[model samples]
Target: MISVLFFVLLGAMLGAALGYASQVFKVESNPLVEQIEALMPGGQCGQCGEAGCRQAAEAMVRGALSPAGCPLGGANLTQQVAELLGVSVTIADADIQWVATIDESLCSGCGRCYKACPFDAIVGATKQMHTVIRDVCTGCKLCTQVCPQQCLTTVALPPDSRSWFWPKPQTAAA
Candidate 1:
């Protein structure tokens, strides 16, 4: 009975010491890392090549990863992350956004593409020809999959003066 009591006391003392040590040595996390993690899609899909969103955010804060590194978040998230990190990202390299284009000649106008488009980029009547709003299309290709006539095709939007960025000059490695 005495030995059991002694061991229980010893265990409790050790547990208390460990808990106190943990509290004393606790490291505060960066708020920026938290903000970046919250901006992620929270899929934990590992598509970004990180173990999880938290690790990815830490990497972003440390400059080990690019602000636009998360593939699932796409261009909008990339822009938000870039803005939060105070970094500039070129649209061509960062996103390479595509837009859906409907071939009027081949379209059967069955309304399948219109229904499948999540962005509401297609506009037309049920039986009439549909036109894709290039500005609103995310190029997800859902419309292409649902198109009965296979008329919806995704095309890389040509970079205009606004979307284009000047190439950064290469520096000599002195």
Candidate 2:
């Protein structure tokens, strides 16, 4: 009974403290905006064809940007982002980035391209010939920058994996 009483007192004290702190440090919640913002491809690549993630965020909240804005986050990320913001979404076609395809037979084990990849998506040992993992590949054309032999080649989506969406219509004809 004594222990229970002590716990009750402690709980009451903590609750009071929390309530007081809340009044002192209140923050407005922008749940609707932040949720959609999180879905933006973190790459900040602007390749989403948007200016930046935050720009995309503003557009999303205003319902100006489509799920199509972010190329890296692609469909899955866009869908969740749209749901959270209570906005409509039209998923863009899958854009498989043209990642480097390592030709093992031609591989020199030079590790040159490995140095060029900023995303750390390539895997291999030094002087032991590196390999590209397509799933993680950003297809930035950076790795191809370092290859002296020019083995790495970018391939357009082979059509099997390609999908389509209504292109953002031109508002003003030039």
Candidate 3:
């Protein structure tokens, strides 16, 4: 009973020390970086020349990158990010929206496209018809390159009423 009591006390003491240390060494994230990241598209496509949106946000906060760095987010997101960062920015043309389409007749159900898709937008089983989840697809084109049957193709998505947004204003030549 005495040994059990001693062990309990020792455990409690260590727990208390750990809790105190955690409180004393708490790390706070920069709100600016969080805001910038929130404004990003979260595509993780590396189109911004960074590994991911969080890294891009950190770079933007550190003045090593610009708000226009993300092509996937386009001019609208750049404008929003620029406003949040208190910086003037020129908007670039929005990227063409693309969606993958799998020709069922040509699809061998090899599952290559499914395995290559980073977003899991392609859904099918081996020896079955694979279909592209258009809504979930980021149109990264990873599926097209990996399809052994060459059945996958990417096409520009026509904007519907719900998908349409105001076009960016064109600037005059300096």
lDDT of each: 0.80, 0.69, 0.83
Runs with alpha carbons beyond 4 Å of true place in candidate 2: 1-34, 49-55, 62-64, 92-99, 109-112, 138-141, 154-174
TM-score per candidate, chains pooled = 0.53, 0.51, 0.76
Off by over 4 Å in 1: 1-66, 69-80, 86-95
Cα error, residue 123 of model 2, in Å, equals 1.7
Better of 2 and 3 by lDDT: 3
lDDT digits (tens) for residues 1-174 of candidate 2: 999999999999999999999999998856766766665545555665567677787777677877556665655566677677666765545555455687777778788888777567678877787888876776667678688878787665443332233456658877
Residue pairs with colliding backbones in model 3 are: none
**RMSD in angstroms, candidate 3?**
3.2
Clashing pairs in 1: none
Order of candidate numbers by lDDT, starting with the best: 3, 1, 2
Model 1 Cα lDDT, one tens digit per residue, 57-161: 999989999987876566667778899999998644645667889999998779988887756889998879899987676666778888877788888777666
Q: How big is the positional error of residue 53 in model 2, measured in Å on the Cα after superposition? A: 4.1
Among all candidates shown, the one with the greatest lDDT? 3
Candidate 1 is scored at a TM of 0.53
